[model samples]
Target chain A: MIEPFTVLSSRTVVLPVDNIDTDQIIPARFLTTTQRDGLGRHLFADWRRDAANRPREDFVLNRPGAEGARILVAGRNFGCGSSREHAPWALLDYGFRAVISTEIADIFRSNALRNGLLPVVIDADSHAWLLAHPGAEIGIDLRDCTVRMAAGREAGFEVEPFARHCLLNGIDPLGWLLSQVPAIQAYEDRAACRA
Target chain B: MTAPRTLFRKVWDRHVVVPETAATPAVLYIDLHLVHEVTSPQAFAALRERGLKVRRPDRTLATVDHSVPTAEASWASGLGEMDHAARYQVRTLGENCGRSGVRLFGVNSARRGIVHVIGPEQGATQPGMTIVCGDSHTTTHGAFGALAFGIGTTEVGHVLATQCLLQRLPRTLLVELEGRLGPGVTAKDVILGVIGRIGVDGGTGHVIEFRGEAVSAMSMEERMTLCNMAIEAGARAGMVAPDETTFEYLAGRPMAPQGEAWERAVVEWRELNSDPGAEYDRSVTIDVGALEPQVTWGTDPGMVMPVSGRIPAPAGAGHRKALDYMGLSAGAAIAGQPVQVVFIGSCTNSRLSDLRAAAAVLRGRRVAPGVRAMIVPGSQQVRAAAEAEGLDRVFRDAGAEWHQSGCSLCIAMNGDRAAAGQYVVSTSNRNFEGRQGQGARTLLASPLTAAASAITGKVADPRPLLEEGRRIA
Candidate 1:
């Protein structure tokens, strides 16, 4: 369901680490299953591992404060490697609606939005500010592409007009293509005639 | 304003099957289809699902790479019962191609090498042809003056179903290089310099045509290395107009037609250059003589500077964040960053040429202790060729692991990965965060730098190690 009004949850899980790759987001072991269910339990499956290769409780995501986090506050260049759609798929499946980072990888940024996850860029000071105010909530209005954080702090970020429009309309690129069925049909007819 | 004759316009006009309109996608005529292990599975699956055949299957060539277990799994016994991701992908490629009557150059096949390397070596890549692959580094094929681009699975399906697809014409930029490169500076430095000047997104929607005196003088392999990283600057594709060098490289390959056909092909290829009055949307120029060997300090291809230059202080939010996360400080020379691992293999640089370059460095040197070094050949054919020349033995004797061919450290989609916080000097295309593995730091460089780093156990210039005997065979 597309919610008319959305707010970034205050319960943020900070991964203040750089170069968090797609495989680490969802390990290859969990990828064998085709479906999207129960992926949340396996998020950060490899990094959260103990010396015995079991889930490490000391990992941030396993901590009580970060359980069921919907907004992931990550370090710089988050989602930098791989073109696997599974990375965003797993992140979305695990209930993360927004990812706040200093820099997002080029493909990963586009992939996240297409998969219905929002990627936000905040300056280092803002990032530190958010980390300091752990329970600070930010209200994200997709229509305006603006984030309103606690204590009256607000920032204007940009999303591609097409992507913003698509997210608001709950239309994937393929779905957007289908919406232009009339134009597509006409083009096909003209192409056939030319042939 | 004088009418700008852009590289994109010239190439686009040459290949345009139908005129452009707001409603219709540009009808691009494809000349070759190069496939590899990582991206072909889904395309083949789409073909099977549609109950369609690969249109112009002869134009389509397949080679195995990516997901190759180049380490311990180089032997078949090592792959037993592992159900490794690459093993499945390799098997799928073989089975799918066999069923479809498309050629699958398997690891067992002598011709199998990195797709880009094998394509050019066999002369499948030629001028004025459009090439597409599922993998991004397909730009490597552009060195032959063919338009090339990476496509998604759906686009792959579209190509498989019809042997053609609708595409938007890209804006063209003429990136002119001036002056001779300094000694120790190579083609890698040239492209890395271009990327540094033009940020990653600078070429976002354009096709880059490299020109000028310096570029025209490069060898085919060097040209491929430059074009391969076009995607790094966010270009749709890149091309170098075909010339004598291009013609020479294709002369004896098996796929290239001989006799009158070869003559005719060359005649046609000579016309692939941009017309004098062609128009371009934009242009950028670089003076290569001033550039030094480059190394990346931050998480992006754009976050690179000359090895002699210090890491820049974070300027934008993105830059600051990238530096902080990489645990780097401003003004620190990138040359001496202690590398935890060194990887030299990928579609970008895993050819016989790349191997020869690395081998020249590894000939008498020992890898620094506590530093893991691996050299995965781009293809099985490349592996054999290296072994034939004792390059593999050189690597092994120098304390580096000689691996079977595959896209080993490029994306690490298979089991091969670096542990968290591990810093890797890699020859792969992108050094984006976690590209090698989760929390794994990647420093992008040419194979020479990767091998040199492997030997010295830190980021070091490869020039000294390679000066005497490392002319690319």
Candidate 2:
């Protein structure tokens, strides 16, 4: 049910804060429905709104020229806490095609990739450059696995080749795994016989 | 010949459905798959959309936890005062489980509890198994020597369709704790001390094996508590070798093997320890005797200090921000800091033993006048056991509310929250901003420390209070 992703060029929203956990991305209270569509409205709900339901002027998403940004440039250890897939759901629902960070939590990175949200890990210099220029256009070439800043500075990153193949083909791993059922059953049978 | 194996390698290698090749990660077969309401709804929907049946429904278990109310009235009335959206998720879980033919412990079920607590209590967690849940706290099951970790919703759907996960191998780290723990110090303190020493991200991309004398001396519940916080330390999973203590705990549980099967399981479990010549990618040791009752002073679990210690000076911008948010001054003592609430419950420390420990401190005492203290048992079974022993009476007489089981106040997903700016001493893990409630300050501690703080309305140590009671007796 995911769209195949290959190349994306979009302006980046800068959020230069480390350890921005999944809870911050999408608070637990907002994780009410199974449907992933409406979650974009609640993304960063706590940080975006005051207790009185007024929008916070200083929050990055509320600032001017922050709309329609498809790439998020964040700090280190992004999406660090909780195994809530709601975090990535909110990000993708909000139109973020990719997130660039110096580091991403292991679980979050896996979740993002499986959901067709590209998690781009760049060097400190590239991260700093993106953060320094808010609303700057950045290009991600999934075919080549490279990230390019608007100034033509580029960084090559690594994504698991299999995950890349799945994303490029828009294939759900379950189908592939289902095809390997015979092999799985064989392994189980062999292990049981040994036992 | 293969190298000698650490506990992690031994268990991980046993679960490999397909070995890692040039193009794909290894396909690891899961022995148990725990599902909760919060993360499983989408996964079930995904299955429905694809017209796929749950491949191994027998291996999967479901429960409603995060969105369930802990109040007895809510259970009595079916959905009393519960929000519409929250009730929808729980109801959907029941419907999904019914359609998928997977067993679910509904809100009113006697077996209902936090998924992690129910797994061990029912003996679903076993040695040398691969367990997956859509919850990070699934690491708590690793205490049984299972290679358990949380996965995302998509992976949850994949596991439901095929009882296998594609995972790359993780490095192993051996965390050894030598010497005996001092009186009043609990597993929570030890883990807090470990996280403080290692920092939050120190265990990234690794599986940690907790070994040595202190870990060996811990009870099954204590071991679970230690492994539960491994995620807080950034480890993918944490495990303790299954010993006689582990077997003893699993022996009579409902799902545990019996008779000949039980005997065979024990024989295999006994061999689960790390080989003598095994090598860990990293190893560190801590002297348990040197630990004290520890508490978090800031927003994260890593910003911890001993109860007897002073607040540390800010070391960086993060530390300064944490201090400012906590409303604490550097160099000031944490002992007399005022607390408005004390919560004793969570998958981390909500077992029968945890309740008994807190009850011991609350007996013949009353909660301090302005503090709202509550004890939510980990499960329905734990609640029944506590009431049989009159532990609930002790908590009630001491002015603490005794509530039914669920993850209450830990993540505050079910309308259970502390007031903004209020300082709370909680027995649950995670002190992240607004984890307890929006703008609330949480100090993570053990049940004993939380009970003591409830009585004094401040951060107080339980050792002196316990010893004083002994002297009076």
Candidate 3:
């Protein structure tokens, strides 16, 4: 059963830097296995490893209150490099329901929506505000494309109408097409000529 | 009122078949189907499970890339290192393609490279065609005016079963690239610059037709690099009109037609260009010469600036929030900043040309004392070609670690990665926060720029290094 889009639990996880690729999201070493399981444990393979190759407790994800955090308040260009769906799969599997960023890589954005991960794009200033105030919970209303803070501050965003429709219904592009009977029927009628 | 139609819609509308009702699937005729090593295993297994042959094998092409080792020594050990299960899956893909009579560019084939690379080089990526592969970068084929997108394993099975799948056409966005590309700036920078201008989600719901002199002048490889990253900007797909450069690149390839047939193919291809005065739902133009060798300052590709520029201050709501989260101050110059690591490889830029370009910078120079650098080839073929020219030696001599290719450090799905809080200069695409490793700082740059940065132990412009190379021009 598809899950309808709803307000996601949003909060900023501050990293304070740039150019983060998938390697950091889920390290390359974990890719050797076919199983997608256990990836959540090794999300930041190299960085999380200690001098003796143990998990580093200082990592944001390893720190207090960050475990299983739903909303990822991240830096610009949220997903870049490699068209791996696994990056989103890892993020989703790790319990992030939404990613708020200033920008994203083209492929990562597509994969995100298809996998049911909502990527919200906010302006730079808003991103900074959220970053500076960690644990500041935010709410994203998909129907309105608005992200609001608990403090009553709100920002309107723009999402493709089609994407918005799909998100609200928890349907992908193909799934959305499946919902439009008339258009599909028209297409079928036209396609009957080729048959 | 009738809206102006886009190429994607026209092509999509022409192929969609009606289902039993609106909720039923609209069967779409797929013109080209590309397959690679990682995702085809299960698709083949399902066919065998059903005792079904691949439908429309003529439209299907397969290749081995990921998991194929780059060097002979590595190839042997890597193959040996693969668990029995992984080996079985790879062999199954090859055997199934063979039994189904699908053209398979296997490990030993000279034509084998990245699945995306093989398509356009061989003219299999035709205009007005809908191409799909299980790999997400399949969008790379769109550069030749095709409507290409990636599918999952289940969708792969559907395409194999019907030679058609369900899809709706995307709206069109015209992205015009004007002016000239500056020296040392390549197609990678062009796409990066686009993502930077539009932000990542700007092209959602649209198929982008890239135009203007800058796009027209790019080689098919360069064009593929551009279109490949379109998905990064949230575009459904990205394409360029077929032109002489397209035809020339297709000529003489193994799968491409010869002589008169080729001429006929070109005649048809020439007509694939968008009509004059075609309307786009949205259009944006970029001046190319104004672009410098770009580098990602924040995690996203659009969080980028000229190599000489500083990290942009968070201005808009999103940028500010992202910067605050990233713990970076606004307007910090990225140049001359120390880096602990550097990487060069990915579907985005790890081709022979990118390696050669990086080598030109690293040939005689050594990486900074403490900085670690890694060079990974995009495919086995690229590795072979690089080794043939002794590029590997050049990389090693400069204190760079060259690894067996399989989406290394690019995604950290393999053993390569950076420590937390470590700063890196990488040639791979995307710089999303925590992309290289959680809490690690990623600075995205061209391969040459990455190499130069490695030598200087800081983010540095590649132009000076290129100027020092007498043969670069």
Candidate 4:
């Protein structure tokens, strides 16, 4: 079940790499499990671990001051490969409430949104600003569709109103769609009558 | 007045269940939904949690591909290693499909194979249809003039509960291929050339319509190979307008319409092409005749060049990083680069024709010493067809491991993987870092290219081998 999301403010981690694909977010080897739990432990497993399976201290997630970061500021073309929802599942499991990137892939964006993970698209300047200032607290107001940086700057973003409604209500779109089945049937009936 | 309609617009407009309003995106009805083991388990769980069943079970198909081992032992037992997580995932899919009254092509089933390959083989994928799958390569169905794209696991759950997807219409891009493809240059080479020219994110936010003589000349399977990697170009989907080739391929398949139904379907499909004066948001043309067999030199599919070309100098940070990871130097020739492993499989190029092309090169030759080569058919049906013609024996005699069908060594989720630090020439789609295995470098190529490389143990061109064979004959 997805939690209702409205406003979130938290310290953000900066991952300044472009085209961070779903495979990097969650490797295919770790995808054998059906359950979504415990995936955060394997997030970026290849980059986070050495060949001997030791944790690499140089990686950003392993660095100090990166703990409990609820927002991720990433590079362009984020989530660029595969249609695996494991990418967003791992992010949400890792305690990230939102992701800020210059661009997001089509399937990844929809997946993240449906899973209650906010995918915020901002201008390159704002992205650079957020990356330059590490551990900065960023604010996301989904109700207003704007992201506020720690430096007192604001950028507007867009989300389909229906997705927004679903997110705000903490409801799956499937239920709403089921409710509209009668209307859909009526439309089909009218088309058949016309034919 | 409205604008003239492209092929994408024609198909999409016809499938819209509800037009877009201020509050929501259009609810587009899905004609087919292909499910695989890797992404459908959680979707089934989600459905169970809500006490819901699949809305249209007949329109949905399930297969165990991504997490299934390609070894013959596993095929016989319908199981891999006893304690592996992949076994549980594959088993869970069978249970879910059985419980939901949805059909599944399990390991024991002769029709079982990769979702993308089996769909068209069964005649389930057709022109003017909207298809969705939890795997990105679902774009493979677009070759039949269908509007197919990948969806996330959450969206998979939604689609299971409702046979509709709420989607914003994607803009259309026209990719016109001019001239005829030269001999020995296959559709894999054509797509690789396009990705190299356009870069990785070139087609983002657009549905690409591949038009002109070259695409029209391609066989249905060849067109599928072209469309299978559209996601590598960041396109929402790739499509080729339906023609006589499309009709001929679907005529006798099991799920295809028969007799009068088939005739009526062909007439409607013929009208599915873009209007002559239709305008796309963006257009680009490539002379395919001028191209050669292409290979990826870096992590991404976009870092590709013709086999006769030299490695490019690093132009950006990404290029430098890709070069560093791939253990390649700037300005080096891609040819003569030694490869330790050669894989001829994956949805990209594992069809019957692909196997034939590879077999043609390996019939009288042997794999180079110290090279590990394997040939995995895309599906059980493909495997059966290849064996009926002794293609399997040809591969095995040439020192290649001919294995059962599934997605093997493509992503290396199963036991199949390249050794660390090994360079692999593969016929799979992606060559991203550690895509074949941890710390393994991969070069994406056609089956013919992979076959030639297996013989020489390097990035060797297949043209010389083809010419030599023709002269000998």
Candidate achieving the largest DockQ: 4
> DockQ of each candidate's interface versus the true one?
0.11, 0.69, 0.17, 0.70
Displacement of residue B55 (Cα, Å) in model 2 is: 1.1
Q: For model 3, what TM-score does chain A reach?
A: 0.82
Model 1 bad stretches (over 4 Å): A1-195, B1-7, B14-18, B76-78, B466-473
TM-scores, all candidates, are 0.77, 0.97, 0.74, 0.97
After TM-score superposition, what is the CA distance of residue B186 in candidate 2 from its true location, in Å?
A: 0.6
Tens-digit lDDT string for candidate 3 (B178-239): 98888888898899899889866677667888999899888877888899888777777888
How should the candidates be ordered by DockQ, best one leading?
4, 2, 3, 1
Runs of candidate 3 exceeding 4 Å displacement: A1-195, B1-5, B18-26, B40-53, B67-73, B76-112, B315-330, B363-373, B384-405, B419-421, B437-440, B471-473
Cα misplacement distance, residue A30 of candidate 3 (Å): 4.6
TM-score of 4: 0.97
State residue B403's C-alpha deviation in candidate 3, in Å. Answer: 5.3
In angstroms, the error of model 3 at A82 is 6.2
Q: Worst 10-residue stretch by lDDT in candidate 1 chain B?
A: B2-11
Error of 3 at A88 (Å): 7.3
Model 4: residue B278 alpha-carbon error in angstroms: 1.7
TM-score, chain A, per candidate? 0.82, 0.96, 0.82, 0.92
Tell me the whole-model lDDT of each prediction, alpha carbons only: 0.74, 0.90, 0.73, 0.90
Error of 1 at B137 (Å): 1.3
Model 4, DockQ value? Answer: 0.70
